[model samples]
Target: MKLSKKQARLRRATKFRAKHAEKGVERLCVYKSSQHIYVQLISACGTKTLASASSIKEKNGGNVVAAKKIGTEIAKAAKAVKVTKVAFDRSGFKYHGRVKALAEAARDGGLDF
Candidate 1:
């Protein structure tokens, strides 16, 4: 049977996460929705979120601009807590459009991934 779109995304996410688990480093995870983009810096142990940022407070959440802002915010937050490097986990989303914008902005903001 063919998997639905959401199911397919989840399958990809599971596979990505499995590989991420082996790295044993902090992870920068990004999740995007129709109305918002969320990002989190998770501890290596997967027990804590070192930092998080979202477009929920912004007037526009569904745009590349908003994604970039969230990425900059997340990078600042991570640095304030002394987090410099992390694994980028796109949560099964394609690395284009908003996701790409966010990642580039984060890099510009000084987070290495």
Candidate 2:
């Protein structure tokens, strides 16, 4: 049977996560919606969140610009908490457009992935 789009995306996410888990590094996860973009830095053990940021308060939360802002915010938060390295987890979203912009912005903000 063919999977639905959401199911397909989730499948890909699961596969990527399995590989990431093996490295046991902190995870930088990104989730985007129609009106918001959320990011989190999860602990290496996967039991806690070290830092988080979102675009909920932005005038246009779903755009690339908002995503970039959120990325910088997350990077700053991670630095404040002394987290400099993490594995980027795009959550199965294609690394394009807003996702790409966010990743680049985070890099500029001093997070190493």
Best by TM-score: 2
Can you give the TM-score per candidate against the true fold?
0.95, 0.96
lDDT of 2 at 54: 91
Task: Per model, state how many residue pairs clash.
Answer: 0, 0
Q: Residues 1-113, candidate 1, lDDT per residue (tens digit)?
A: 99998999999988877888888889999999999999999998788999999999999998999999999999999999999989999988999999999999999999998
Give lDDT tens digits, candidate 2, residues 1-113. 99998999999988888898889899999998989989999998888999999998999999999999998999899999999999999999999988999999999999999
The candidate scoring highest on lDDT is 1
The alpha-carbon RMSD values of the candidates against the true structure, listed in the order shown, are: 0.9, 0.8
Q: Name the runs in model 2 displaced over 4 angstroms.
A: none
With candidate 2 superimposed using the best TM-score fit, by how many Å does residue 13's alpha carbon deviate from the native? 0.8
Residue pairs whose backbone atoms clash in candidate 2: none
lDDT of 1 at 48: 94
